[model samples]
Target: MLTYRQTPPIPALGGIVARFSQRRCREAQRHVPAFDLPARLDRFIEFYLGEPVRVGTGAESPRAVPEVVLVAPHTRPGKRLQMLGDVDTFTIHFEPTGPHRLFGLPLQGLADHALAAPDALGTAVLRLRDRLARAPDFDARVACATAWLGERLAAARPADGLDALVAARITPGMGPAAATDNGRVALWARQLGWSERHLHRRFIERTGLPPSLHGRLLRFQSLMQAHARAPASPLTQLALEAGYFDQSHCIRDCRAFTGQPPGAFLAAWPDLGRP
Candidate 1:
């Protein structure tokens, strides 16, 4: 058993941030708990200090990033620390960003270096949570965590077009205006200059979901994000911008993917993301 507690949120440029404290490392669950978390809530800056835990983020299942993850601090089972930030909630790290190096390689790639162990990444995470136990202020703890992540991210890939595409697919902003029903996956593919197959391949490899599904979900997110910005946003417009033909179409997609109506879901989780 473990104790899980969330600190008050600290606002960032486009997201709300928080630090979590836990007693006893939590076990990986069958699924990463699903929450219509406030879209303002982005990723986190995790600092490992004591104990140990594992984390995975995917669509109702744990999966690996087809690309690579960079772990910082040269993770050592009980010694060096671990950390990350701005992480997409849906993304699960199969590898640490660094122990000292950049380019976030996979476990197999780092088998030779020090700060390696079968459970190095996950184990180091739990240690991070433990260290938070002694944190005097939430901001202080969060600052440490954020800086670590920033450093690691700086060392990693340059947010290449592929990464940007994934981000665009994962998180999109919506306008208050209604979207046209004419939207289609092919249309988006053309806009990105990618063949449907190429886009789908990279999206699935990076995200766990296919391009079409991602587009659907993100459309929902966009509409809702727009609504959050402007309460008077026309509902029909929301659906259209999100790629639905009409409000009814948006409702159907919501029910199919989110098991709730767009209206109710939005009402239930205010400021929470469309996903």
Candidate 2:
């Protein structure tokens, strides 16, 4: 059986960390599909125990994913992740601006990619990984990860004030404003007292994608999440609710982002293989 649990981050790190999730599967052999959807507005820091977690499949079969990976916001689909064999992992899902806050670095390199955390973020995470492997139980592992993040959070440099505010406001589920004139980058720039060009640069540096692309992705992600919640809802209604002008626009965007139509995407949601 698969053991899964999500716990809230410590209060001190709440702004940066949305939540912490742990998943363990002890069945000798298993396949867990990590779907490639729209550009995530957030970042994920993962720690894997037991076999290393793998990404793509070889000509013959798949392999284990890396021990630690920092997944940055991606605007398109990546190779599907098939976790083969027993696995254990705890993940930190951070807010859109969380990675920059946690790592104190430009996120351009990490965007649309998952790389070895130690290579990208350095040895601090590796040390934490070792402690996680040594911890006796779930609670201990959580404690270790939290303490490690706390120290880093303290030393990490802050994001540009305007950039942080803009990112925090560009959250998911912002309604029609997101897809129409209300979602324009210039509008936000004016409101934040930043030149449009300056805002664009800051966004790319801190969040990987510019404001325009990020807003579009957020709209698509809203539709996806709503569809996931109510699979039976009419596509037209879901489209409008997610800020698409109509069902066709929604369908087009869905195919563009997921490489599948809406119905097929939802139907294949339960299976990780393909749509």
Candidate 3:
């Protein structure tokens, strides 16, 4: 049996932490299918308590994942992950700016990379991992994670104006004014009293991708999310509703992000559309 649950962070930690999730698989002989992890806007810190997963890109052989891993915001497609044996995982999903503010890690260098948490965040993470492993239940694990993140939050630098702007305004699809991409970028720059170039540089520095590209990935994510919500919906309808110009546009993005066209990709991984 596979069980999964998600818990929102305490009100105080809402800005930095998105949520905490736990997934466990109890059947050792069960065949767990490999899935393509799509590029995401948020970042993650995952702790494995049971068998490590195997992750690989393209034709390369999958590698065993570390016990603790930090997954940065991916610009392109992500690695395929396959689980083996029994699995237990606790993950911290961070806001786009959360990891940079809390850990002082530059998003620029972390993009498209999954680093061992202990190596990136040092021994403190290992200590927290030990505590999580010993946690009595999911609630206890959340408490442990909350306490550790709270301590970090105390000394962490607050997000700057750009971070706040991106978090608040630069989301999937176009902004409220319904302007072209360049126009929206210009408007955002004016709000911050920055030139367009400065905005681009700062956005890349903070989020590991240009704002335009980030918006594209977010739009792609929205299409997948919509498909997940209504698997029976036609692709053209989903595409138009997700802010794509047309089905062809959506197809192009699907290929770019998942290396397959919409129908083939969804058919091959039917579970992706499951809620």
Sorted on lDDT, best first, the list reads 3, 2, 1
Q: Model 2, which residues run further than 4 Å from truth? A: 28-39, 57-61, 159-164, 170-173, 176-183, 271-275
lDDT values for all models? 0.40, 0.71, 0.79
lDDT of 2 at 24: 80
Question: TM-score of each candidate?
Answer: 0.48, 0.85, 0.90
- Evaluated against the true structure, the overall lDDT of model 1 is 0.40
RMSD of each: 11.6, 3.4, 2.6
User: Order of candidates by TM-score, top first?
Assistant: 3, 2, 1
Q: Ten-residue segment with the worst summed lDDT in candidate 3? A: 171-180
lDDT for 41 (candidate 1): 13
TM-score, candidate number 3: 0.90
